[model samples]
Target: MIAASVGSILRSFVDGVIVLNDRHEIIWHDLSEEISLAAKAGLPISELIPSAGRLDFSRYRAHSTVNGVPKYVNYSTFPIQRDGETIAVFSLSTNESKLKDWLHQTIEIKRQALEKEKNQRNERNGTTFSFPDIKGKSLAIKGLIKEAQAIALHNADVLIVGETGTGKELFAQSMHNHSPRAKSPFVAINCAAIPENLLESTLFGTVKGAFTGATDQIGLFEYAKDGTLFLDEINSMPMTLQSKLMRVLQERLVRRVGSNEVTPVECTVISASNEDPEKLIEEGKMRLDLFYRIAHTSIYIPPLRERKEDIRFFTDYFLAYYSKKFSKYVPPFSEELLEVFLAYPWPGNTRELEHLIENVVIRASETDEAIEVDHLPAYMRRKIFADPGYRAIEQKQKETKKRPLTSIFSASHVHYIQQTLEETGWNISKTAKKLGITRQSLQYHIKKHGLGKRD
Candidate 1:
């Protein structure tokens, strides 16, 4: 019975088999002809597989050049023992079915299951993602999250400031979910998005006589009773309304439109603005007193361009997320593509990154190959290659065989951009249009290349 079992196992090793001595030399092998038809007993296994001698692990995977193309091979070993002592070892190879390939085949099923379960759980959690759901590891983000968590514990109002698409609302939701009033309604309204006529009533409620077709109803504040009211784009609110809001904060009371009854405020108000509060005040877009009342504890979220590592971090996350979402066998991005991604100013910020991944994954095929350069946008590729600055770095890299330079532009690109900015009087929209890039992308390069305001 033992002899039959051993014979079956040896027959199963039809792909390739080799018995090696303690010296890493082959005592015998029925190896593939492609390896070496001239190979024989007593030859060093390293002669056939150059990496054989370096196999420190019982099983290891490495790439080897085959037909001018690199291919991965897996080598596994089993000890051949005699009288409870190991004498020789049998190494086997299944080059046709690489471990990586096998893992990829099964990942589709596993990923889909995990993604479905996660979505179900998220739906259960009421659509508000907690801090852990926010993916970031940069010190800028780490410090911000720590500070936000501390602020969440209090009942005082918060003011969150960041550029558009920097996830101002995400931070607000995270704060609300972690706060003492997590169970209460986390109401949100965009001041800029709503019409001016309805905006006041939307916040402080309205009576039947307030205006035509108006009914006695609660506004966001009363509806959010003992909960949280997120006021987004606060700077866009009219200056007159800002005074009323400030008064409510100071008195902790709100009165309905066309009614004398004052309702005691029970909800905490968290406001958000895309512009700098001080700058807005200087421009007369926001009231100084309102800024003080609403911004008791404020949080500033750094943009994606400033946090480059976070871009890479989010890239990996979005890749996995979109892959599972689409049920595609999407491979990791090529290094060249990642370099382009890191270099991008991401004018749209994290939202842009998310949309970019979604765009690619939906179009990607089920294959084991990595996402190549052609997979990216044509406009992005053209701009990078056409840029004199990028070409300079490319030339530098070829000469030194080093990684791409962090500075995407050479001195010349900087000078040109600076000249254009100076010509436009530093108007971002005009400069971006002149340069044929988005305003956000131009801003990113301006910050990165130190093209600050001219003296």
Candidate 2:
């Protein structure tokens, strides 16, 4: 009698209410007539709501199609406890299908708003970098590029992992340009740079009268529709915002702030982080579930230091690049200066190298034929000269002037061969050309020395 009375009251109060045992098997329900009783019979709650299995979140939205009709539902699950132990779960669900029309209207309104903004901003729908723009021939970089190119045709979310100055944005842009959506906008946002209070609305969008100061707005997700949205420094995003981001990624829908209506989002997301994502998860700075969702296709860019063979190539490229920009003569680095560059550890990676060369080019005299140590900044000069590796190079150069070439070759032949291979991106022909030997001779040396991929 009591159970019947409670069911009667719940049916009048809620659109539907269901009870489940600890194992999530439905024990009882007061479902609406429109819902499918056949579908709910003797099934786990997860069958109705995917996220209901863990029961981790406080609320969840679920959509189902029944008899050619769509049903949108808002679900709230509560634990029923006795003697301080949860024995069953009670879930209250409300049909939100009525809001479907509202969702569509909201999307159309935002689209019109965004179209106006795009015209005012004069935004272009393309990127600056293609595969060729990624300046590296090292095996690590070449492998990374190959993976990126292969996946660009797909629409999966991409996660780029690397240390700062590893050119994560360059990879993101290249992937966007190579994809089928190349003609669409390539929107990039720095999650760490934006203020947290405004970050949510900026990405997902906002409706008029959503807040006192808020006006109708289209977010980055909408702006990048039919294209790519690059989220840089993702680890720096607040944990609260990360939850909403995960939902958008999973459902491909975004609900503006202060609005219950959800709009469809079709843009591909490419997120990046300079820090190790695992460490960030352990530190509570990033959510593990979000990481898993966004990292469906992962790319890790090796640091410049790890690929030291590319240093000289990048140096020369940057020199020529900045020389043309400044309209100055492209001066070569003195032997002593080049030795210092090779020996010194570049902590700032390619960006640092580029900036340093630009400074050197600007400081060069019209009569200068080569850049010497004096041309470098004071800090770099101090760091390079203080390095013990530079001291060793100086001693080696002095000894090279006195000893026979064969003696030097006998000492560092394998090491020289390995460095050349890496610099040429393991291309046998290029390595041979750089070493002034035939490709067959290079292959024989590689096998002879058992040199493989470098660390």
Candidate 3:
């Protein structure tokens, strides 16, 4: 009589309750009838739950649809303690669709606020106009900036190629800032960062109810309308999405993820790749047709080692900027420190240097008026004093050459070679033509003195 009364009380609740063994196998389900109906043709009592592995069981909350209607479910699993030890599992799932809807709305509001903050930063910093604070006084950088400025006037697509941290995005932003689309949005998206399965929907937005959990929101393409879209690491874009992107470029229109309607966008597309897009194409990681579409104008940014003169300029800029920010009265570089800056081969380029200076200024500001060798990071000090590769190379050059190590000829010659290469994409034929020399002569010189190999 007591068992019958407990069963009658349990059947009155509209929640699903299940008991499981240690292996997560369901031993009994209180709402078996509802579960079976929700499962459609499948047996819900026997079949394992989808995405159950992702659930913590201790505190799991999510939503699923039953018969095309959304159902919010909050599940909690407690270890069944018995005989001073856990013997089984007790699970409780409640319908909380109304609460779930309210929470989702709240989250969306917060997300929008964060997005606005990001956009505001972009505006204040002129992210589309400024270079990546790359420090350099090298002739290569000067000439490259000039060319980028010239190309920015045209509506042609631009492709920036460089190794990672070589500031490809910086060049792209600089190009857009100098271009006709300067005042418009410069939305940047990393092709590799987004999941391959969702890359298409992210690039071209989806309509409400397009798929499960999809809301009416604009995608990257729409967000960048009438402006510039900087696609970073374009080589990592999936091949399937590549076809769709190629079409959008050629047609100037994008179809939303689940809609037939086509939306036209007037925007400039600038793409950057750490790897050679041509090589990616050959390796089946990128599309050749898409490459040609985006490579109407291509710019290559030189690495830090190849533009040694810029190091001092960068260090000075960083020092002053960081000193002001940290409220430090840091003195100008001592002769020894300046030499250290010029000689060290910065593997991480401008970004790394900026971070190092910021650290120094912070430390020095806390206790001293000026930054000294001790305030600098350990890596900077080590590279300055102990790096044998650069020291050995400098020594060898000094021994083999008759001119002073800092001779005007050496500097000017390095500048000339870099300028020629930048103008020609390191192509021997074009560089030779610009320099008024034969291809064989250019090759002879490049081999004679290691000029074009860095590219």
Q: Pick the candidate with the highest lDDT.
A: 2
Question: Model 3, poorest ten-residue lDDT window?
Answer: 46-55
| Tens-digit lDDT string for candidate 2 (285-364) | 99999999999999999888788668867877787788899888755776567668877777777888888998898988
Clashing pairs in 3: 136-310, 137-310
lDDT of 3: 0.73
Off-target runs (Cα >4 Å) in candidate 3 are 1-128, 131-135, 331-340, 364-375, 379-387, 390-455
Q: Report the lDDT tens digits of candidate 3 across residue range 1-455.
A: 77556656665763666667656677766653334456565645334243332334634433445678656565655677667666666556666676677898999999999999878858743473364444468899988888888988998888998877778887888877777787788888898898997888888999989999988878888888788898999988888888999999999898888788998978889999888777798899988899989999999988776776677667777877887786667655543355556667677777778888888776665334334567788877777658765476457557647655555336676678777887778888888798875454455456545675453
Task: List the candidate 2 regions with Cα displacement exceeding 4 Å.
Answer: 1-126, 386-388, 391-455
> Per-candidate TM vs. native?
0.59, 0.60, 0.54
What lDDT score goes with residue 408 in model 3?
A: 30
Q: What is the lDDT of candidate 1?
A: 0.77
Residue-wise C-alpha lDDT for candidate 1, range 1-455, written one tens digit per residue: 77557646765864567777766667776564433432433344564554442333334343345456544445566676678766777766656435466788789879999999877655433345779877786999999989999999999899999999998888888888898888777788999998888899999999997789989998888888888899999989999899999998899999999999999999999899999999999998889999999999899998898998898788888988888887776766754566677776777899988988888787777663567567767775686677665566567657644533344466767888999999999999999999986554576577657788867
lDDT of candidates 1 onward, in order: 0.77, 0.81, 0.73
- How displaced is residue 130 in candidate 3, in Å? 3.9
On TM-score, the candidate that comes out on top is 2
Residue 2 local lDDT, model 1: 77
